[model samples]
Target: KKNMVKTGKAALLLWCQKRTEGYKGVQVTNFTKSWKDGLAFAALYHSFYPDEIPFNSLSSKSSAEILEMCFACGLRHGIPRLLDVEDIVEMPSPEPFSMMTYLSQCYHTMEGGQKGRSGLASIQVNESQQRQQPA
Candidate 1:
């Protein structure tokens, strides 16, 4: 269950990078080759499928234990530059932007956020103010 999130995230980032970033929505030349290579990871990442299987060995483990193992397996390591994995890997902070949110924020949004960080959300000069004149 936990690993599925990791799988989806990697696939999603790879999806985003291949589909959204530098290539301009086009698949890279080696995409199919990489996808084919990805299939061989089915055992360690086997839980990443729509299908389910019981693991007698893991039945006794806690979810945290399973998640720890997933991290150790490097299941969630390859991250887009938007997410600072080191900053987030520790734990809960007052951040509205969690790791997933950070991932989704992407390049353009980061630029916008940096602008907003200076504190003005958006200052819309009203028509009346526009009409009043620029002094």
Candidate 2:
């Protein structure tokens, strides 16, 4: 059971890393410490809805403010506000399960809006299809 949990966490972490790959200053190494600054959540949100949230403009905000914006955006898109901003802001590292649950909800919410595949998978499929086409 422990190993299964670890594997699940690893997969979720990898999914987040792939989603937030090119966003500046956002590195998702884990569900806890990596999200302490709230940039990871913002990056993930921006990755799916780039036009909705300006990624570059978030640099000036405090961590709490950033988290508030991110959570608000999520709520707008129907993802529940699972993690409290105060709890996250006060802790050096937020609780892993809470982070993971919130992240998983974000993942499902974003991916559900896609055409039956994750964003990364859709991009890869498009690239492969383009490669197979004749000049």
Candidate 3:
């Protein structure tokens, strides 16, 4: 069981690394320390939505600000807020489980469509209406 958990974590980490590859100033080695600066999250988000998030503009922001932006964007796009910016910023190394859970959610959410420079196809979301559309 422990090994299974480790394997799952490893796979998630590898997925993150692959998605964020070639992103300048972003290196995802582990879920804890490597994410403290929030650049990893930014890179991952940018990978899915490059035009929405200008990669170069992130460098000037503080860790807290960067985290806020990432979380805000995720929230806007229907990704749940599994981790808090305050909790992440205050700790030297965040708890890996929470990070992994959030990242997995991100992966599944962003993996649904063809990706281009402009990002995924238009999504129609109506807050007042709850209707399912067939694929």
Candidate 4:
């Protein structure tokens, strides 16, 4: 099960990298000191907010408009968290999400799609009402 989960994450990250070609503001190469980390960051944000990252969908958009959207995404969530947690000088270090909990949450929600399952995503949410049982 662990191996399967890792494989799924790897596949997702690869797909994320491919999708980032449309982003002009952050040149995937020059934008981040670590390419893999940068790509993974972009992918996670993209997965959570697909509508925010449009491809050739907006032909009428000016360069400045596209840049604003990309910048908003890059600075808004995971990236800032990543910077706060990791030593930025070290490229490709594993820092998970800026808030590590979100990574697991995202994986749980999206992992179903990786197994040829259509939109049946699972969420590992812990309700406050459900208290832990003492052993």
Off by over 4 Å in 1: 1-44, 47-56, 75-135
Worst 10 residues of 3 by lDDT: 116-125
| Residues 30-101 of candidate 3: C-alpha lDDT, one tens digit per residue | 989889888898999998887767778876889999989888889888789999988889987899889988
Candidate 1 lDDT, 1-135, residue by residue in tens: 876555444443443343333321123232222222122122223333213312234546554444344333332433234423333333343132343443334322433446533222122223335658967
Output the worst ten-in-a-row residue range by lDDT, candidate 2.
115-124
Q: Write out the backbone clash pairs for model 2.
A: none
Rank by lDDT (best first): 2, 3, 4, 1
lDDT (Cα) of model 1: 0.34
Name the regions of candidate 2 deviating beyond 4 angstroms: 113-135
> What's the lDDT for residue 59 in model 3?
69
RMSD of every candidate to native, in Å, equals 17.8, 5.8, 11.6, 12.8
Q: Using TM-score, give the best candidate's number.
A: 2
TM-scores, one per candidate: 0.23, 0.79, 0.78, 0.31
Better by TM-score, candidate 3 or 1:
3
The RMSD (Cα, Å) of candidate 2 is: 5.8
Candidate 4 or 1, higher TM-score? 4
- Clashing pairs for predicted structure model 3, backbone only: none
Candidate 4 regions off by >4 Å?
Answer: 22-33, 36-86, 90-135
Clash numbers, per candidate: 0, 0, 0, 0
